[model samples]
Target: MSNSRSTKLHVAMFPWFAFGHITPYLHLSNNLAERGHRVSFLLPKGAQAKITPGAETASDVPFPLHGHLCIAFDQTQDQVQTILSSLKPDFIFFDFSLWMPALAHQIGSKAIYYSVITPVAQALKVPTKQKLEDMTLEDFMQLPPGYPSPSVRIKSKAFEIAQLKVVAEDLGTGMSIYVRITSSMIWSDAMAFRTYHEVEGPYCDYLRKHYAKPVLLTGPVLPETLATKLDEKWTNWLCNFKQGTVVYCAFGSQNKLQKDQFQELLLGFKLCRQPFLVALSTPDGCATIEEAFPEGFQESVKGRGWVYGGWVPQTLILEHPSIGCSVTHCGYGSMWESLFSDCQIVCVPYLGDQILGARLMVEELKVAVEVEREDNGWISKESLSKAIISVMDKDSEIAGLVKYNHAKLKEELTSEGMQERYLDTFIQNLQGLLD
Candidate 1:
């Protein structure tokens, strides 16, 4: 393919309904727009409203209903096709809608499978040759053929395997989740991931070899600068604590914990004896976080802890001086944020991709520690507290080592022009696809 430096391209984005997927697409769109590419972003009304203020986010829909949301997304194909015909974009960027490649081809536009998850996670779970339906539990327990990382394997735990099985099964759509994602990858003109080679080169290379196509990396795709500040409420509260003395915990928008697990997590924080802030959805069957709290939990930790069930300014909070540690669910976005922040990292993952991300951090990168789980996937208060203390304790060897490693890696990733160079190369490769 010839490299064309002068041609400007038009791109359209249609991401899965989840916030994790939509937010990254928007960031990539903004990056392209800044580089003088004409872009059109297509999403449902609720997602659009959520991106703007004062409207309910599509995340309000519980996780289980995401399958139905995919069905609805599939139903919008005709409308998407009509828009593509009218707009006539040069490329359509998509994640979950399996029919997108055909639609893009119909409109004479190239389809790009812009994966928001880490390539390692996809490489491990998505089968290369065997039929997804033929995948047995034993197969799920082992690593895929030619998987890049020996350290990253699916946990043998029952719940972990069960979670992987769910991803392979049909989500109310007639197509299994494995088929929906793999077929899209097979048909798309090119593939892309929101990652850099320095962090995930082997995995990306593995994908490139398996798919036999151009695989482009867009770096982390974080905003050049945060346009917003920490809300006053968080600022005031965090300021009261000493520098590097507070722990901030947030599972992403969609992970609702079982009531028992939620209480155990809070109790774990209480045991850590650090000033802490937690933002989480209400537990299953509970109307509010307060309702889900363990008995006398409020009175016991009144001065040192705060729990709220609403959207929070997570990025700003991570930037605060008082936040010494972050307890995260290891979603791709959160993983990047925690890596970039100056905080000690602790992971409590709930999904398959998250499990892989946690392994990459805790085992591969040595930048974070993961909370231990029981055989049934229940996170005990003691395990959570131990993981925090291992990283947060002043004299701990593990704490000092991870901090040193994380800082070195962060410096390289955030070096001047690194992200810009990735985006520039990414654009050139997209343009090459046209040639």
Candidate 2:
């Protein structure tokens, strides 16, 4: 530990562009700020207007160009060096981009590599990045030889896996997932994951063994408090449903469904006969709800369902007693929130680590199930209905198991000082580095 008696420090945070990545850094910044550390959270220039003020921004390196890994390396190296020179922070936390650690070293700042995705994902994705770009769904399901944990049963349909491969190829970072994560492992002062020991202990151990470095567990850095009130319209609508009867469907901000998939989802909801609320994106140029939704689909389920175009307060909806199960894209944020709210999860993962997350929830945690798909990977309404009913039917075996898992995970998540322990240990390590 540093001989300096003062525990206070200045920390700078920089995250990637996606909402999933940005939100976690914001949460960590909030925690650090509350604990008396000064933080400078940075973002791209245009995004500054979207978030609350106090964000430092670098110029948006125009996309296609922005997506090039070499451009990111140069841009971040200059931008971060500039920030460190101006702020002279004691420590800096950066997202998954590989170039950052060397940038921190060049600028004489201590770097802590933070993963917004799960550690299991980090281990699995890194080794497979190259092969993933070209592998078929069948080849992808066969886990790579060095995949860290065998306990996790790797599974997902062909088309769904294909979707994630496309996403990976589109990544703006110059390096592939393998290059990015392995580079961070070699260069950073330390590493941090957005998970705890209880959920993924073995994978955590495997990472430590492989990297031979100080791997820190940041727990599930969730909001300390939840929304106390919801929109009046939402409140009024939810009041009509009975406790533990409604299925909440949200595919996350980034997921876009094809027209047929969107229609199948609606048809599944209708078939379940469960009062539900589904939120979907109204893609650009779609003028009205009628145009966006399936033909006469809105009319088909008028009283029993509600459809939202965008921006739903998911936490508030989950907290309401009426919510029994969540039909989700299995994003990390959605998974954690579902665990916290004690909502049964029905996963329909669209891309990237979401497939892994869904697999873990279904196989290891025994808390959720993925929707069944046809031979060609098309999700049928019948399959969706079965998955929904399995979780929502209180008297069913799957329902009982899901509730048991939800309660246990919720207890673990909400245990007093679980979040605090992770944050405190992190600060202590940073303070020690000063010595």
Candidate 3:
């Protein structure tokens, strides 16, 4: 063990461009610095503002680690060494595009990557044999004329055993070079995750026994993130809404939908007659949304909902009592936020990890429901309306059950027993480095 008093780690954090990645990496950096470690966050220039004002930032922020610490380049094997040669930090914690084996061989640095969501949920997505890489144009174009995609043959058959083997092997080989990873199981790491062990315990157990990485979760890092005065203004609008009264809807940044799907969601929300706040980008192939809306649709819902063209304060809004339920793209960050809040989730996950998060929310968590997705990837009006009503016009049974479950999870969140145990573990890990 490095002497607690003798060694001080100069740690670097590299997180992806998105807010999800940026926010937590900042939090971890902050935590390490508070603990007396030297820390610098490596990020694209544009995101400098994402770091809070008055927060410590290294003046020699840009330094050659392996070569020159360049973050924007498509993460490749060569860059890792370039970073190591320069900064030579005791450790580097990365959140995305981590090709571990290459990094370790390039520089014998302890490189750790944080999985912000459940890695077990991720391992679940490892392709089963029988999965095809891409659907032919024919399969892609077909609308799920009648049923959900998972119920259909295409998605379920994805991931053959052979494919799973290859993906697993690829990951395992990376561990051979590095010390694997030391953290995951996001919620258990965070006191904020109110999950029942009875349901997800098997998953948590699988991770602990097999993966061997300590499940290190800090409490939900509040994405109460901001950039400038513009963000402060936007937050003001959110502040105006009543707690648990507003429907907070946002499809995460990458999952841009085509015009039809966007219109369908608008029309469905209009049909539901509830107050909705939506954060959106223009749908695919359309520069503006004016052409997509149904006639009189915009005027009709004008006073009832707010549709902002860009980003929303996702984490802060979700915690608001006025924002009762979330309509999400099922992004990993959003999923954990909703789970941490123990709020209602309405999933319309667009792709990749979103779909994986969707399956867990629908099949396991039982706190949310899925919005229908046609093969064409359009979420139709009927499906949207049906889902809206399912959560909005709630009966005594569901509301009661949701409350009960939320309460149980809330207990876990506030439980001194759990909090002490987790914090003790965190402190111990740091202490171990010293011992």
Badly placed stretches (over 4 Å) of model 1 are 1-6, 52-58, 125-147, 150-156
Error of 2 at 119 (Å): 0.9
The number of the candidate with the highest lDDT is 1
Instruction: Tell me, by TM-score, which candidate is best.
Output: 1
Error of 3 at 316 (Å): 2.6
Minimal lDDT window, size 10, model 1: 49-58
lDDT of 3 at 261: 68
Query: Each model's TM-score, in the order given?
Result: 0.93, 0.87, 0.70
Ranking by lDDT: 1, 2, 3
Task: Give the poorly placed runs of model 2, Cα more than 4 Å off.
Answer: 1-6, 52-76, 125-157, 160-174, 283-285
Local distance difference test, candidate 1: 0.84
TM-score of 1: 0.93
> What shift in Å separates residue 57 of candidate 2 from its native position after superposition?
12
Question: Judged by lDDT relative to the true structure, which candidate is superior, 2 or 3?
Answer: 2
Estimate every model's Cα lDDT from 0 to 1: 0.84, 0.73, 0.54
